[model samples]
Target chain A: MTLRELWFRLTYPLRQRRIARDLREEMSLHVELRAQELLSRGDVPDATDASLAARRQFGNATRIEGAARDAWGWHWLDGFRQDLRYVLRQLAHAPLFAVITMATIAVGIAVNAAAFTFYDAIVLKPLSVRDPGSVVRVVQDARITAPDVLPFSAYDALRKQARTLASVVVTTPPQAFATILPGRSPDEPSIAAARFVSADFAPALGVGAAIGRWFGPDEDAAAVIDYGFWTRSLNADPTVIGRRMIVGGRSLTIVGVAPEQFAECTSRKPSYPRNVPHSHPP
Target chain B: MSQQTLAAVEREPIPPGTLDMLILKTLARTGSEQLHGFEIAETIRERSRSVLQVEEGSLYPALQRMLVKGWIAGEWGHTPERRRARYYRITAAGKRQLERELESYKRVSAAVALIIQSA
Candidate 1:
């Protein structure tokens, strides 16, 4: 559309009221003139009869006014506004129906939103890990897709024959430990949650140490602190690696600080990781 | 004693789509003197010798459409009796439209006349 046409459409509403008023005024005047014409021509005996006859001959004044609005290209808009106002008045007269309708719509929207959220979180959004499409937790069928922990011998056998798959990781529930850090009071040891996992857990989940390397396979007493725990309890100490910390009255070496993103694999983030042998702890 | 009370409906309704032409022709013939809505309707009726009727509904909408199309311009003025009224004047475009419509109307009506008479 041309700029002038756009400008006219934009400004038309401002002129619409005056134009509509003028049309009404002109139509009424035409009726009055027709009535006077009838009276002057001796067609009717009285002014009242003449006026009524003139109006009848004029044919639906309200409809003519509406058609005039249509001629100016606002018929539908004016009609819709009038309809909407009428609907609002009717709705005001029946408040209960309005409330029930509004409530039904709200409940429908809430259900749809909640269902979509769950679908997105569980099905659409993938787990945040490197090559996550290639990784999946194996669920056993002892009780219909149960997450039963596998024995070390079964895990080892599967690991040997699964040449096409990445390394398998056996993760266990986190255990609470009364942890005492160096230079802190041993009496008021903080309760820290620590995860136990196979040595291959770090490489399998693509976890990298923020400070030191992952503890060696033989270092069974060493532990790796999570990034969040390192920052909250240890102030992100750079040289804290190789330091000995007391856990459950036993001293264990602080081997590494794992990156922050590693915490997303489980429901609750572990404060630190304690290495378990390839076999489950006796 | 209006049109309804008259015998046999003497005034025929003006043909559709010809209202604009009649309105424009009325304004064009008057030249400098701008006529109001009532005057235009009155002129058409008298010119047709009371044989043609203009419904106010069709008349006002046609005038409005012409105003929007730049064929006619309207201004609010007072009648001789000091009554407020809208006066309309034909524009150049309206004159051109009147000539076109008149030519077409003459052609069609002549064709109809020839057919009816021949038949």
Candidate 2:
């Protein structure tokens, strides 16, 4: 027999209580029969001596008892852990192939887990979103625009149609550029990005700002920078909420800082051109 | 009894021809009782005296082949003391085969002996 098969056979009795009980009974019967045969042959021995010899031939009695106890406590976990260690040692002996195989398997497992997590969160998990089934993306016909830069007029038409979309909202992400404003840094120009969005955009996504007030649904020429920007750029000024700022060469009042999670898109949803449907129409 | 038992323990050489045939005859004469493997080897060695000595290794393989060919059947049981053991018994086909082989050997031996006497 192979070493693995022998190991399995030797351990099976100890691993299972029912099998161990049966084996103990069978072994006792065998020893009893032999002892009786010896007695008939005129060999006189005490009952205790016969029992001791029978147990000794098998191995130490206490070892078997300990094995049975440990089986209940760990329940094959110890054996599986040992097997894993042995497998690792064997893999290490073949270093080059082991490395390649491990790398390949790790990449495959990571990608599969990430995709499943996203699918579970976005598609399977119930959302408090409005018209969730009807919510869809209406984008550029040519299928090529920045993900944070959907056109306002296209969104307006989709919202008006009523037959196509329940509602349409446009999101304009922050555009970063070199800022020359005095006292912005150590008397030197530095990079800053700003965003502009329609008021309904925050409510459409069903999230709200944490501090101060959010913009009204029909309010135009308004914006909300990220909380990180508000703290670092405006020096945490409480009165900064109603201040005007230049974004994309257009004037917009800072209504409030956006909430933490609303900072950026964690996933890269591909940008589509101006005339093509990027996603199903909402 | 001691001499016979001691002699039984020793190996004896056999005549060159018809080794397997002799084994078949021995099993046939014994009424095919359930016998331990070592006992079978010892019996054949003692009864044949200097004429035959079947190696224990040869017996096992031959018995296995016989089992496959349907000449004998093997079964696991106890010895008289109930120790785990295997026993072999000849089948009807094996008895028939023994009869044919014995006759062929008798004819050949007789013919060879007559030619040697004349020469």
Candidate 3:
């Protein structure tokens, strides 16, 4: 192929409209010439009839015009553009179907994304503390050749004897305690999800308080609240520190609110209105 | 539309791919003068004694293809009545193509002739 032809084909999209007009005009002139030839030969009665006869013999001019343009090249891309336009028009005609289809695809992607985000944060992600790799959980199991379910009686024994390790702390799971809110009637006390932990629980985990402060070592009747309970039941009261709440029939003062992320360490099930009273384990 | 008109002319459609050669031959015969699209179709018909009829559908597209192939060049010119028309002139490539097509056609026809005569 010559460079001239190659250049023409490469620039087809830019010049297609002008080329189409030129082709139609050229074919129309062909029709006019055919009409004159018919008149010279007396094939038709008058000029108008001769012209119409010529047009009839030429077949569809618009179709011929399209075929002539197709010879220039890139007809497949043109056909695809037309098909896309047709699909868009149909989609616009049925707005509900378009919305439903879009929503279905969006929800499918969102579900996978959300599940992965949670799995990464909870199971795969490390705990947010200094030297998280060094921190370990100690529990007795048959596989470890130790007695299962360490009782609260071992709390003092583990601290005194486990001096070989860097640090040792003990904590009891949430215990049942009837709780009274500041605004509510004291008689209608609901169960408060409370935990009793050793003095080194916060220092061992290296997590600090989000508001107020952690409890003092050997402190009595001082309560620490996680951020969720502070907002949900206590209405995120700024004066929550030093405010007293009746738990287990004893008044415990709120000392601090736990940071939001630290809530994962205290409870796995995410209970509400949590109170961690600094008392002996269990 | 009518059997009468069909019987009078007995117009036969040009064989596929032969129209380009015929067009090249028509332009070559015109020598220095360029022939527009209608004249080329008419010349082919008249030369074939009205046996061939070139449809605008085939004629214009073939012209366009030949134009892009560098086998023919078209330019807008005025008719005797001062009306605008596109005139086509055969190029060197068109003459070469015409010779190649004629050689191929002759060889194929001769082989067919040999087979038919044998049968």
Best candidate (score: DockQ) = 3
* Residue B41 accuracy (lDDT) in model 2: 58
- Give the DockQ of candidate 1: 0.44
**Model 2 agreement with the true structure over A1-282: per-residue lDDT tens digits:** 436434544565465665445334434544465455344544437666655554443454345434433433344776898999999998989998899999999999999999988887666654434345656655454557655455656666666776754446664444465543222333465566644344466566665665765677655655665666666776767677776655434455667766654443322211110111224432
Instruction: Write out the backbone clash pairs for model 1.
Output: none
Off by over 4 Å in 2: A1-22, A41-131, A140-156, A159-167, A172-174, A177-189, A203-206, A217-221, A228-239, A248-252, A264-282, B1-119
lDDT of 1 by residue, B1-119 (tens): 66465565488889988899899999999999999998998899889988888878789989987877778989888999999999999988789889999999999999999999998
Supply every candidate's count of residue pairs whose N, Cα or C atoms clash at under 3 angstroms. 0, 17, 0
Give each model's whole-structure lDDT: 0.81, 0.56, 0.80
TM-score between candidate 1 and the true structure: 0.60
- Fraction of native A-B contacts kept, per candidate: 0.76, 0.00, 0.78
Candidates 1 onward: DockQ, in order: 0.44, 0.03, 0.48
What is the C-alpha lDDT profile of model 2 across B46-97, one tens digit per residue? Answer: 6866445664334544554454445666576776766665566777877877
For each candidate, what TM-score against the reference?
0.60, 0.42, 0.57
Error of 2 at A21 (Å): 6.1
Across A120-223, the per-residue lDDT of candidate 3 in tens digits comes to 77787677665788887777776755443576666557766876667776665566778896667887898767766666667777867889877777666777
Best by lDDT: 1
